[model samples]
Target chain A: MYSILDNSLTLRTQLFSIVGSILLLLIIINLIRREYLKEGYSLLWLLMGGLVLIFSLFNELLFSFSNFIGIDYAPAALFLVLIIGLMLISMHFSVAISKHEKRIKELAQENALLKSMLNKKERKRKTSKK
Target chain B: MTKKSVCIIIPAYNEEKSISSVISSIRKISRRYDVIVINDGSDDKTKEVTEQTGTGILNLSFNLGIGGAVQTGLKYALAKDYDIAVQVDADGQHDPRHIPQLIADLDSGTDMVIGSRFINKTNYKASFLRRLGITIFSNLILFTCGKKIFDSTSGYRVFNKKTIAFLVRNYPIDFPEPESIVKLLRNGFVIKETPVEMNRRATGESSVTPLKALYFMASISVAILIESMKKY
Candidate 1:
């Protein structure tokens, strides 16, 4: 809440928080513009932004929560939690993508089969006609 | 006897036991029609048996699931320019004799024909979870696809040139049956379901266990919803 440029290590942490939040905001903006990520998943990003904004504006409560969690630094603790959560979600997405990739491959192979069958049938039809 | 050219695409996985009977039954009825068995990376003698039957076989390098295997058959039908394509199960439940009725309807200008087990009888039974999953998925398909689908997951169906062409271009590789109908309709293709009886599976257990049934329905529902929404 206080003005930045303080000499305290806490101020340095706050400076990083400001930078990270801005980067996240920019990412959200870019994703929305590109329409790559669906709205269903963007809720997580919105939650992240809300959490960061809360930490940036109200430093005392976040620190107490961090202390409650037994971390010496709340921002660092928050960052760690975010990283773990991201890793889990990323793993989930990787599974989904893997399933989709498998589906695509299956379809491709089936398509190839159909093509070969059609050719054999064509050859038979021609021989019979002649 | 008037001969008709039909292609039966079977998606088989570890189905070595029943592939012989399945292929032979179809051959007995439609000798002129071609059969393509998609070996979905089965680590069994399914590929061997299918090859011995002298039928067309496509070996997938790995297990691609049922949807992937069937889509592969559709792609072949479209590419080879078959008159009509029929999707028959590798398991012995679906009767190959009824295939002619499906193809007949397709010849009568039907874009797609489905063999409905629930039309005159409700003899098909599954786990309660599977039934519920099918119900919910059918409703979702109805909502999104703007059509009432009686059997959303039935693999026994017939496709005309129109349906085959569309599927070759863009086929749903997951939860294909019900969702593929939506894709076809969205692209202005027509679909029809004819009443055809199905016996209990002759061999092997069903791939859709209760837990997997839930996962299958939820994942496929999401895929269908997303894919349909993107159709524009």
Candidate 2:
């Protein structure tokens, strides 16, 4: 049974978790507000911030959950979650980059084809005038 | 039946030295066929050379590789309602003289026809390693599709309107020659090959070097496998 005063989390750990979660939430909100990050991506960051906030407020809940997951240390479990989330975000970015690259190639090809057609038409006009 | 119009697609990249000669050779063959040159972001006088020939030219804003360039030409052909589309290299290697043979084969209801150098004999010779790579690709394609293709890497090909429409919608972007054959076979398109003589390149270096050839073989093999597993 985990108690609030189980001494599993120190005051410094609690302060760090609260401060870090607040900072992440602020950064994510600002990014979305500035249109630097899309809403779809901001949702993921917001969820992470919420999780951090919840774990920090209820230290007992985090400790119990870490024990349930066979983790000896509660903070390690939080770090593990963060690592997995980062890996997923990075993978998503890679897929998005591949799609954009394909689109850019298609656009470039279309631009070239249209330019050539315009040149041909201009030449035809000049020839007819001559 | 009405007469079918043919469009000759030449995908050239920095082939200023040979583009004019190639255009002239095609012009000598016949005036009935419409010629379109796809300048794949040539950093030279390729566009001007093609323009001087008074042929239709499509200048790409950037280099999209050979497959992308060829597909762009196919898109143009499809848009213009061309009945037949022929692919000829910008370099003088692909002789326009054999284009008639490709068209004649297409007349027999063939969906796609390939101008192969190794059909009857090895008229055009490559390095031993290159030949080995081509042979491996041929056998691999044969094993997977149950179709024997002697010159799987030859870009000299003819496609009917149906094939052009299909390619315009779906075509690979890299090392597309061998892989496209597998795709065409999987889609149940009838393909035939005719003997054609290929010349050595008039100028400029080939994109494929020895190291790149190895990489090309590996990637092409994977592409063929993936293409075969795709549903039509």
Candidate 3:
């Protein structure tokens, strides 16, 4: 509805799509480095974002292919599907992460216990010399 | 303050209704021992109740079972340099008043003091099967450690610094007693027993159902045997 020029708004929408994809990519990257997102698993979304960004940059070719595939607004449909799929996958991964948080806590407590034991042994050795 | 400082560690799981009275009972004896309650990821008001009682609490964000909860408590005692450590239940099955007797044994230089129900009398009100299971395992613990342990599964016990240090390093996550007794004896640490009458749980059901009791006995027996085979 906001299309000013016939093809001009399509160009603007493609630019917006590319920018949004890049922003998502940046967020995913930040999450990866922060250890909130593990690697190999997150690589799929990163690549998908990149693919969407690339698809947005080439407009005429994608439209021609969409016409060939007999799907109206293939780019928009693909974008919607990808967003919904990613949301579901993100939800699934969050559940997995939530499940592992307990294990991580147990590991942390075990680590603390190991450190405590080591310090006590060191103390014992020092005291034994006296 | 060198009265062989004892810290009673209670590993709580979903015992909000009973934990306050547990805390209060301990508080009555708080002048003798510091109470530390490990609220092990209860999906209830366990933490809130513990906090209301102003007991020292370590709130685990998720459930790590009773074994992990108790180990966390042991780690805390080891870190804080507590001279003696006691494990008590938050469900109020074990009386807090019996804590002094364990400490008294510890004061007499017993490295570990276990409150045994069968030590003086056989009036323990456990189910027949439970009594049988305890008898079999306690006998095995006696054979392995060369010391008769009338109650191998009692949580009410005291450990001195040496035993605490050893336990913090290697706590049996399951079937802790039979293995622990043997471990203490093998390490040349003194172990003693005291008689304490226990009450039926004030709230909550025992985790050991008849079916679970069978599983518990088998699993813990295996765990103890495996632990015995492990070198140190």
Candidate 4:
């Protein structure tokens, strides 16, 4: 209800979207170069950046896209797509986390096993030496 | 039959009050059987108490829930190369006296033996809600695995070395008892259920709340379905 964004893409917002998309793409590339982001993830960010760049470049297409999708509110259509994109990214992270969680569990189990074996050996050695 | 080396895996989480008694009772049952307690990061003296009894113990850095603790014990069993591994609750719910019978069942040509309370009439009792959950899970397991198991939720179980090796690699992390049955059954492992009486827990109340129970039901149902859908 608080969405005051009109169907017309304000030039100021259009400029911001273009700048933001370009900036996001640059940051993602820089992150990959700095080893902060892996190549595996940089591709996803770059694709998102390309999509945002395409939309920012063509407001006419954005309007048509929203109209085609039955979203009367053009900005709402963009928001919806952005929300879905966020959801997908979150889900990808969740899948990655699940994989790592299993590994962490195995590591913890192995750690306990080794520590217990050491504990057993130390006790046995102490008793036998006495 | 050759004499089999057995490991009694008791996954204890803050079970300090009853762990000592549980260990002693198992030791009383047989000295030949090795006992290992996976101390699930209890702030209590569970590790110390277990050490005093001279039984082996794995002190996890944090609570890994019941499934993780049990899997740790399985890993230990696999590493130690025990012929059979029987899991007993550290809360004193499972009687150690039945270990031999479970091992016997395992030896009699089954990969797994579950100490079921429903196979025969026993003085053991459970709440109506809990029983409803048990019924639902057992049926879910049956539907997924094409076999009727009376007590899918019973943790009092004995696993042969092969099963232990499998579970060490694939045991579920949350509420594993029911899903493990489905996984085992689907993978062509035989699970035999025998009637046995279980003592009411001697110390703390069950950790299950109503909401957790609901989640447990839903998660396990989905897990069973997914397990059944796998091709191999």
Among these predictions, the greatest TM-score belongs to: 4
- Checking candidate 2 for backbone clashes, the offending pairs are none
lDDT of 1 by residue, B119-218 (tens): 6666777668866877787788788878877777788999887777777767676667877877877877777877887878899766676787778878
- Put down candidate 2 lDDT per residue, A15-84, tens digits, no spaces: 9889988898898899999999999867877887888888898888877777788777677877888888
Candidate 1 at B76: error in angstroms?
1.9
For model 4, what is the error of residue B45's alpha carbon versus the real structure, in angstroms, after optimal superposition?
Answer: 1.1
Residue A42's lDDT within candidate 3 is 88
Estimate the lDDT of model 2: 0.88
Model 4 C-alpha lDDT per residue in residues A1-130, reported as the tens digit of each score: 2223444788998999999999988998899999999898667678778888889889888887887877778888888878887777788889989989888888888889888778779989999999
Cα deviation in Å at residue B17, candidate 1? Answer: 0.2
lDDT of 3: 0.78
Model 1, residue A27: C-alpha shift (Å): 22
Reference-based lDDT, residue B23, model 2: 91
Better of 1 and 4 by DockQ: 4
Candidate 1 residue A4 Cα shift, in angstroms, is 13
Ranking by DockQ: 4, 2, 1, 3
What shift in Å separates residue B228 of candidate 3 from its native position after superposition? Answer: 1.6
Worst 10 residues of 3 chain A by lDDT: A1-10
Task: Provide the RMSD of all predictions against the true structure, rounded to 1 decimal.
Answer: 8.5, 3.4, 12.9, 2.9
State the lDDT at B174 in candidate 4: 74
Q: CAPRI band of model 2?
A: medium
For model 2, the superposed segments whose C-alpha errors exceed 4 Å read: A1-14, A48-80, A124-130
Show the lowest summed lDDT stretch of 10 residues, model 2 chain A.
A1-10
